[model samples]
Structures are given as structure tokens and as C-alpha cells.
Target: MGIDSTEFWIAVLQIIAIDIVLGGDNAVVIALACRRLPKEQRNRVIFWGVFGAIAIRITLIFFALSLLAMPYLKIVGAVLLLWIGVKLLQPEPEGQGHEIAASTSLIAAIKTIIIADAVMSLDNVIAIAGAAKDSMGLVVFGLVVSVPIIVWGSKLVLRLMERFPLVIIVGAGLLGWIAGGMTVTDVITREWVNDNASYLRWVMPVCMAVTVVSIGKWMAARARIKPAAMIDLADNANK
Candidate 1:
């Protein structure tokens, strides 16, 4: 199906959301794996690792596109994306940043990131494929564009994350929007939308988005509390 400008924007936004949601775990893996290198080599390791991850992710997206074309897969993909969006709102455990070890090899660092990226990116692959549907070119284009943005944007993104957590909020909202589109595109819902015409064509997507974002924000709030709760425990110990 030919995509209009509105659909194009939606697809791009969904791809970005998928990238952000799945990117954190990859970043952590990269940081930890590369931390063992010398300061001079750290950048090199990161550069190589990111390059590998981008290549692998693009390949994986092609696989995702193929899988998404199977009958009934879009429904499954929609559900999966919804779950992923919800999961992003959950709390992640904090760890001490890894330290540099002289023995850390570049090959090992790249391996760590690639393996972790593959494992962590299932949601991203499914979610983006679902949002992009049969647009193989767009899917590929989105990944090509996003890879550098993620690599170079890391420092800026971190600063923004720290200073304005709302960026994450908006990202989650965008995921919710993607989830909405996925749900309505499901085979079962597509028939219903066709029959109803007026109600479901708009209502289903809007409702799905609202539900996801509302639940996601609530989950995020709960996640935000964990750190504060830990801080309180530390303060009490000091007292």
C-alpha cells in the first residue's frame, strides 16, 4: 500500500520510539563491554560496536518485514509492540559502571554489543515492522538514518534524559501511538473497521493509544519512585 505523508510521519515516529526503547539495553551492553578498554581505545570500541549493531539491526529488520507478512502475524506483532511499550515503563536495575581492564579486546567488545543488541531488539524489530507494514524501503531507510543519530546522539540524549525526563515520557507516548496503529491494522480489527466505517476507523487507534500511554505513564511514575525510595533508605541510614 502506498503511504501518505501522515502515514510516513507516523511510521518515522514509531521507528524512533522503537529505537529509543530498545536502544538503552544495547547502550548498557556497549558501555560495560567497552569500559575495559583504555580511554583512547574506548571511543574506537564504541564506534566499531555501534557500526556492527547498525548492520545487524538492518539485517534483522528485513527478517522482521518478512515475518510480518505472514498471515495473522500483524496481530501478534501488535500485541508484542504493546507489551514492549508497557515494558519500557518498568524499572531497570542500576549497576556500577564497568571499569577499564587492560585485557579487554576490541573483538570481545563488539561481540558483547552484537549479541546483546540481537537479544534486546526483538521488540524493536517486531514493533517497527508492524508499524511500517510492507514498506521494506522505509524500514531500511529508518534504521540507516537512526543508527548514527543513536551513536552520536548518546551524550546529548543522556543529558536530556537527566535534565528533562519528559523526553522519555514523550517517547513512550509515541510508542503508544505506534501500538494504536498496530492494533487497528490487525486482521480482525480491519474487518470490523470496514464494517463500522465511522466508529472503528478512528476510535480503535485513538483508544489503543490512550490506553497504552495512560498505563505507561503510570508505570513510569512507579519506576521513578524506586530511586527515591532507595535514596530515602540511604538517608535514614546516615541519620
Candidate 2:
């Protein structure tokens, strides 16, 4: 698709939207992984990390495009994305920051960023693949455009997450929405979804968002309760 064409621009916009939504988590991981490096070396680690992520994401996008062409794989990917969304809602484990802080070596930090990017990018790969619709040019262009955001946007995103934790919840819900959309649009299920449940193409995403938010909030509440219960037990024993 040429840059002058409407379809190309639309595809580019879709890719940009997908990358912005999905890239936040990756930015967080990169920042956290690099936080332990000396001030002088932190930027270098982040640069390499972002570079590696770009390379891996391009490769994965191509592979995902091919794999998604197969029957039923979209369903599997959708299911996995839902799981990832739910996991995103869960509170970070205590001492996780300390664990990251212990990796003081620049090499280790860069490695961490790359590995985390690879692992966390499944949703990104699938979503971008869907948006790109097998157009490699669109995929590459969109990703390249977003590279600066992924590289330098981490601090801003991190601050936003700190001040407005709801962003994380929204992000997770977005993933759930994507997962639902992906599930319905899969080649294996598309016809049935279109014929019998055409409304689901829109409805499923809303339902999935609600489901993710509700479950995540419930889990967060439970996590809070557990600590209170433990404190109460300790008070009773002390009494």
C-alpha cells in the first residue's frame, strides 16, 4: 500500500494504536530492568534493549502472521491473551522491585529487557498481525514510528501508572477486549460468529473488558484482605 492511499494510512493508524496500547507494558519492563544500572550506562542498556525488542518484535510479527493463517490458532492466541490480561491485573509480587534492583550489570539488564520484551510481546505480535493484515510494509513502518515512544516513553508511562493506577486496569481491559475480538474473528470460528452471533463482534469485547476489570478488582480486594487477616492474627497472638 502506498503512503498516499487511504487504506495504507488507515492500516498505519491501526498499527500505531496497537503499538501504543501494547507497548506500555514493554516500556515498563525496560525501565524496571534498566533501573539497576549505573546512571551513565542506563541509557545504553535501554537503547540496546529497545533495539533488541524491535528486532524480535519484527521477527515475531512475521511468524505470527503465518501462524495465524492456520485454523484455530487465533482461538489459542486469544485464550493466551486473556490469560495475560488477567495476569496484568494482578498486583506485582512484593520484593519484585528488589529482584530487579539486584541485577546491577548492564549486560544483565539488557538481557532482561530483551527476554521480557520477547515474552510480553505475544499479544502485541498477534494484535499487530491482525491490524497489518499481512502487510509487512505497514507493520515495519508502524513499529519504526513507535520505536521512539517505546524507548523514551517509559518514564512518562511509569509516572502515569504510579499516579493513576487505573491506567493499568484500563490497559488490562484493553487486552481482554482485543482477546475477545481476536477470538471471534479467527478463521475457524469466523463464519459461525458472523452468522449466528454477529453482534458478538462488538459485544464480546465489552463483556471481556467487564470480566477482566471485575475479576482484577476482586483479586486486588482479596490480596488486601489477606494482609489484614495476617496482621489481625499477629495482634491476637501478641495480646
Candidate 3:
């Protein structure tokens, strides 16, 4: 699709809108994963993360429709998302901050972002493919345009996370919510759910959101206390 064509412009708008609507969760994942990185590494992680995610999406758009419909795929994704959400909330082990090398941390953050984005991008890839249709040009252009938007969003979210730790909980809950929704819609479960438990489509998401938040917060609290407990034990030992 050429730039001058009306259809091309419409498709561009559609693709951009789709990303803006469905990409917030991705931004959250990127921010949460990179939250612990050094200031210098933050931008590097975000840029590479987005680059990796977009690359995955470009590949996925080809099979996006069939991919999500596969049995057990979304269930597996849901599990991964739950694990990621919990891990993101967990406090890094005490004193490991400076111990781990920067390259390792940066690579790990980028890995997390890419994996989560690839898994959670079911709707996004399909939506963009639908919008862009047969025109690879439109797809590339739209995603390229969205790069800055997603980056800005990730930065904004990172700032919020710094200012308010609660945003981490909220972001984790969002992942859980998406996981729950994704689970029920999986091809294997959709029919049974539609026939017998229609409400689960909505109920499951809320339940999962609460479950993630509760478990994550509890684990975070426990991790926060471990250092104090260890110090007390050392003092008692010395005495």
C-alpha cells in the first residue's frame, strides 16, 4: 500500500489504533521487567525489548490467526504470565543487586520483555494483520510509527512505578487479568465455557487478577522481611 492511497491511510490508522488499544499490557511488561535496571541500561533494555517484540510480531502476523486457536497454547501462556507477574513482584534477593553483572541483568530483562510480549501479543498480531491485510508495507510502517509510542509509554509507566510502587501490583494484576481472559477463550475451553459457564469469560479474569495480586503481594512482603530476620539471627549468634 502506497502512502498516497486512501486505503493505505485507513489501514495505517487501524493498525495504530489496534496497537494503542492492545499494547498497553506490553508496555507494562516492559516497564516491570526493566524496573530494576540501572538508569543507563533502562533505555537499552526498552529499545531492544521493543525491537525484539516487533520482530516477533512481524513473524507472528503470518500465523496469528491459527496460533491462538491451538489447544493448550493460551493455557501455557497464562501459566507463564502468572509466573512472570509473581517474579516481577518478588523482591530481588537481598544483596544480589550489585553482585549480578550488568550484561546479565540487561540480557535477562530483555529476555523477559521479549518472551512476555511474544506470548501476550496474540490479539495484537492478529489485529494488525487484519488491518494491514496483504500490504507488508502498511504493517511495517504502522509498527515503526508505534515504536516511539510504545517506548514513551514504557518510560511513563516506569516513572509511575518509581513514584508509586503500587503500580507494580497493578501491572501484575493486569497480566493476570489478561491471562485469565486468554485461558477461557482458548479453543479447547471456549465451547464448554460457552455452553455451560458463559459467565466465566468475565469471572475468570477478575478472579485471576485478584489471585495474582494477593499472591504477589504476600510473597513480596515475605521477601522484604527476610533480611531483617537474617540480621537478627546474626546478632543472636554473636551474643
Candidate 4:
């Protein structure tokens, strides 16, 4: 659907929101992968890596928009978005160190960045595609703007997460809302909503967010308990 400037900006904001919630991993990966390099090579790798990821992600979003033209894909994407939202709400699991030593040549640095980003970016690609829908301009705009955020905004996100963890949760909920919105727009779901037509547009998104948050909390609680129980069992054996 054609949108005016206000609507376009609104869509862009939503896309940015989604990227921030889901894109933190990009920064970490970039930093870690380049950490082993010498100072000069490290900076070069990070710059090229971020650049390659932006280009790759934009292409993926374009393909995703084209794919959405097919029936039922939107529903599948919505369900994936629901999963993504719940995942975003969960605590990030500690990642293993993959830091490699820096390279000497610019080509080596660029290759390192491109290869690492290629391996790490499937989720980002899919999420961006689903969020942008058929709007190629929005997809391009979102990717271009978000690249810097993904690369340079690591410190900001780290500081923010330290200061206000709830911000991430809100981001998670936004994804759920976007998912629900996309679901309602699905050809199958749209037909159903048209028939029911009275209230679902709002209800669906609310329910999706609630469902994701509830499940995320439950899972988080469960994860916290398992280790405690294991510790208790070990203590009992020692006694």
C-alpha cells in the first residue's frame, strides 16, 4: 500500500525499533571477530564488515518483499516474528569467544568481515524482510540507516541495557505487535478478519505481545531454576 511521508516515517521507526532489538548481536560479533587483529586491521575489518552486512541485509530484504507476494508466506513470517519477539525478551546466553587475531592486508580484513557477517546474519535478514513487507524503499532506507546503529551503537545499547533492561522487553513486545499486524494482513488471516471485521486488528497484536512476554518469563524462570536445582543436588551429595 502507498503511504505518505508520515506513514512512511512511522514505518521506518518501527523498522528501526525492530532492528535495535534484534541487531545487538551484530555489534558483538563484529567486535569479537576483529578483536584479535592489530589495531589498524581491526578498524578496517569492522568498517568493511558492517558495510557488507548492510549490503547483504538489503538484498535479503528485497528478496523477502518479493517472496511475500506468494500466498501463506505472510502467515509463516508472522509466526516467525512471534518466535523472534519471544527470543528477544529472553536473556542473551553467554557466547563463546571467537576472537581471531587481526590481519595485515585490507583484502584480508574485508574478507574476514564479509565472511563473519554472512555466517551471522540469517535472522537479521529474515526479520528485516518481514518488517519491511513489499516496500522496497522502506527496506532500503531502514537498512542504510540501521547499519551505523548496528556497528557504532554497541556502546549505546550496552549502556542502555545496563541502565534499563526493560527497554529491551518493550522492544520485544513491539516485535510481537508487528508480527500480529503482519498476521492480520496475511491473505488468509485478512479474509478471516474481514469476515469477523469488528475487533481483531487491535486484539490480535495485544494477544501476541502478551503471549510472547508470558512465555518468555516462564522460560526465563525455568532456566534460572534448573541450575539452582542442580546446585542443590550437588550440595546434598556433599552433605
**Which residue ranges in model 1 land beyond 4 Å of their true spot?**
1-4, 17-21, 94-112, 223-239
Give the Å shift of residue 44 in candidate 4: 2.6
lDDT of 1 at 100: 38
List where candidate 3 sits over 4 angstroms from the true fold.
1-50, 60-65, 97-99, 104-146, 149-155, 225-239
Lowest summed lDDT window (length 10), candidate 1:
94-103
**Tens-digit lDDT track for model 2 on 142-172?**
6786677687777776687789887778767
Regions of model 2 farther than 4 Å from truth: 1-18, 95-101, 131-142, 225-239
Pairs that collide, model 3: none
- lDDT of model 3, residue 94: 66
If scored against the real structure, what TM-score would every candidate get? 0.75, 0.77, 0.57, 0.76
lDDT of 3 by residue, 128-237 (tens): 54445446677666567656656666555556567887766765676667677777877799899999999998798798888888998898887685644454437757
Estimate the lDDT of model 1: 0.67
Clashes of each: 1, 0, 0, 3
Worst 10 residues of 3 by lDDT: 95-104
Q: Give Cα-based local distance difference scores for all models.
A: 0.67, 0.73, 0.68, 0.71
Ordered list by lDDT, greatest first: 2, 4, 3, 1
**Regarding lDDT, does 3 or 4 come out ahead?**
4
Better of 1 and 4 by lDDT: 4
Rate residue 123 of model 1 by lDDT.
60
